[model samples]
Target: MVAFTNFAIAALAGYAAAHPGEKHDAHKMKRELVARDNAAQLGARSLASCSNSASSQALKARSIKRRANAVKNIRQKRGIKAPARKDKRTLEDLQKWEAVNHNMSGTYNYDMFTSIEEVFSGNTSCILAPEITNGPYYVVGEKMRSNVKEALYCDGIDLFLEVQYIDTNTCEPIPAVAVDIWNCNATGTYSGIATEGNYATGGYNSTYLRGIQLTDGDGVVSFETIFPGHYGGRAVHTHLLSHNNAQVMPNGTISVWNSPVSHIGQLFWPEDLRAEVEATYPYNTNTVALTTNDEDMWSILSADASFDPIPQWVYLGDDISDGLFAWIQIGINGSADYTEDEYYGVAAYLDAEGGHSTGYTIGGGGNGTGNGTTPSGTPSGSLSSALPSSSSA
Candidate 1:
């Protein structure tokens, strides 16, 4: 529903935004991830892939050992020197440091890097991050809001998703890179999809559990959602779309796509967690035949396979009811041209828009009311402007 005032505004007058960068650290971080995390993080796992024989498997084992040793030697050589430290550095610089450590917020163990390699793990050209299809449920004109739960919602375990956008080339965080996320409700029904089978909102137009935010100073964004329900055909997952740049406009929005790097991906939950969430209220109500993680229909989740999209392992609290956190770093090709996938929003707000920025008051410009933990580093604000910047872990 467009407000009358929304129609009156003429093209978001004088609104332009520029993202900060820390491209300098890219080369070193890139080298370290390739030489170290690839072999150690992925090791050897049973994969459903077709390109292996006993001879190839043995050779691969030797290759991994050689790479692992190379990484060990490199680390031993560098151990005499203190780790690189940044002081009074830009937010982008801080993000680069955390990203290189494989810890988005410096809170998690170094395994974050190990988890990242799983996505890029294997003997294939995963140079471009895998792109998943945008299902029919996606709707344009969704409010640029944060709290995605609607009044009419199902019972499900609470899910809090935190994402960091890294520059694939530098393996560094990309401050202000953009991402949008949407997922089904507790009963496996999307908020905006058409009424076909059991989805309640299929006939009604709604935007629950759907929102977009740009990465903050740490190349991070956060969303509060539910552990999604598994639909009949797909695994229990949340959908995410990413871009290198984005801008909001009064008449419309504009997106800058790094097609060679533009990404449409899904994030899945751990099977154990899924079983617990499903046992809860509305999830158990879902009537569709459940597809456990063991099912191989929607891309296998094993680590050793070539890069197709896969679910991320998350960091969470003691109980399933407590919120959960997940992180994934996208590997991208910077020099490659943006082609193939069309930009998500309308294009052409291109660099011609002045770099000078202007801010508008939404809900009368009151500061956000949530605790100081959102991505924007500020307290929560009106639904349209509450994704406050924050650190990642």
Candidate 2:
């Protein structure tokens, strides 16, 4: 029931009049549809290509970022310096320097022995007394006037020694150095079995006389023991010295063992003490204690002067009834300055018995009278003598 407009009615009437009963062009319609589809496919392919290009560019950017990060890390590590490593080396150097110097640097006075060769050559001028051996008949008794409560009927005065060394510049202590000591007991008996004995018998184990004590860091050492006894043919006396070894070289440098000897000489006791000790010995049966200055051994030698008796500077003090104690200070060169040449030489002489000389004794008893057994159960005479060289090195 709808009525057509004039335009629509006219168009339909015109189309029907112009081509009445004409067939449509189906081939042309199909060609036009196929062309339009091809254009649409081309546009889609262009868009797909653009998307793939953008993805590739993004991946390249990520790769560049990773490379930049890696470079930055490398630069940072290389630029940094390790201060801790340098500091560790510096600390090690400082420690080595301290050990070498021992803090000494200056001129110091010390006693030098000129006749060391003569002393070791069996020269009797330095010998206080000839070595003695027999003492079975010597009398042992208590004297009311004796200084010590316990007294042994012997020929020598008992001597106790303490030796030490110090750095003059810093006043620091020295270690592992050597010390040599020699003394006569109340009746003129040597500490070692260098002679004979009546009661105790002279021996290395006999504590009555003879000892060596090394100093500690404080530069102090104390020997709590008896004064030496005297024997016939020698006067009351004591001798001591500090010693060290050095290395020798065939050429270039001369090195000292960095060890120095100081304060060498003998010590004399009061006349009263000498008289009391000498009054009870077998040597007293024939002779008396000679004046220290008058004795041939002490007279020919001045303290640190002549070869006789090797005069030692003594630090005299109150008499010890229980034991005689003595000490001395020595100056030594630290190890740092030592060279191979200076470090290879022997510092002291060997005893007549072929032992490294530390001291000497005239007579009292033979070796092995006292505690002849060592802690290791070896005989004291046969035990190894491996004491340290210096108090400090």
Candidate 3:
């Protein structure tokens, strides 16, 4: 018994030495294990076909009209002349566009929508693949609002993102479903988490570039923010989580833990678009190596014959720098029961003051650690209040 106790003590001490300042929480460890299992089983649940129904087409038509009218109003206010219609594009044109390489050395001049007819005739189908993981930085209980930019004068081209949620079971729009999105700034650092790595700067008290919005009657939610910057080893993308029947707490944050996670996926950008955006101002300052769509494994899997995960986007003006308006229809399984702990791949949780470690150790993948500094302040009504009493790091 004495020998065994000594051996155990030595092993515990070695583990402590290996991971400094990281507490081991059974709850968080279990959550991570469950999330991995979900990833292996999630592919079976993904909807393989992105074909649209008549009802879905009608819903998309209304959404297109709404966006067109909004764009028209903006054009009128800017006093910009309408763009001239180009030659009719064939399947060969689409093939060439999708095959655009990142190493090209010329200015890109592709515009998806220049006229109302072109906008109406665009594809409205959306992929329902749950193949992409929620990534490590997905935090629960984000503030409920539309604009996630947090009014910061951040660098990068302005991006207007619109997402429409559709129920795969009924092929109809899903209203009132909550959608959460978060991404890095122009410098490739995410908000609300600090770590011992270079991936994310420690900003636990900050909530920039993160927010949640409920889908409107048309099952649409929009966010006004900057184009996300690229991080090393991963292509430029935005993380998204969907909650169905989740109640917004009095503090204006959703209870992601208790609510069912209807969908967990990442939205991707085209290689050409990413290259163009990264070549411009502050984005060019990010020294991390860019990962093109062809090189990233996840980006490859996100594409198939029946579905394409890339969002349909068009410039808000004559050029890419003028800003962009992008939209994507996401089909989700309404009955797929998943909570934050199951499929979220959560690495950290943001407390009322800043962010707190979940005691889940991020591997050498260098996503980010949960060692965020706790800012001293009076805890206000935020996502922390929505957490259960048992939820503590």
In lDDT terms, which candidate is top? 3
- As a whole number from 0 to 100, the lDDT of residue 51 in candidate 2 is 28
**Deviation of model 2 at 338, angstroms:** 16
Give Cα-based local distance difference scores for all models. Answer: 0.41, 0.30, 0.57
Count of backbone collisions within predicted model 1: 16
Q: Provide the lDDT at 192 for model 1.
A: 49
Per-model TM-score, in order, reads: 0.51, 0.34, 0.71
Model 2 is weakest, by summed lDDT over 10 consecutive residues, at 101-110
Q: Sorted on lDDT, highest at the top, how do the candidates line up?
A: 3, 1, 2
Please identify model 3 stretches exceeding 4 Å from their true place. 1-54, 74-97, 100-117, 120-122, 151-153, 199-202, 340-343, 361-393
Query: Which residue pairs collide in model 3, if any?
Result: none
lDDT at residue 59 of model 3 (Cα atoms): 73
Q: Cα deviation in Å at residue 263, candidate 1?
A: 0.5
Off by over 4 Å in 2: 1-163, 167-172, 178-182, 194-208, 241-265, 270-273, 276-291, 304-393
Ranking by TM-score: 3, 1, 2
Worst 10 residues of 1 by lDDT: 14-23
Q: How would you encode candidate 3's per-residue C-alpha lDDT over 1-393 as one tens digit per residue?
A: 011233333333333212212333333433443443344233323432333557756876787687666555555665646452222222232332244221111221223343454453224445535534565566655677777776553678888778887766565778878788888888888876664443344455667888888888888898878899876656688887787776666767666544566777777776657777888999988887676654443443354433456676666565567676777787666776555233234555565665654433323233232221122342544434333222221
Minimal lDDT window, size 10, model 3: 100-109
Pitting candidate 1 against candidate 2, the one with the higher TM-score is 1
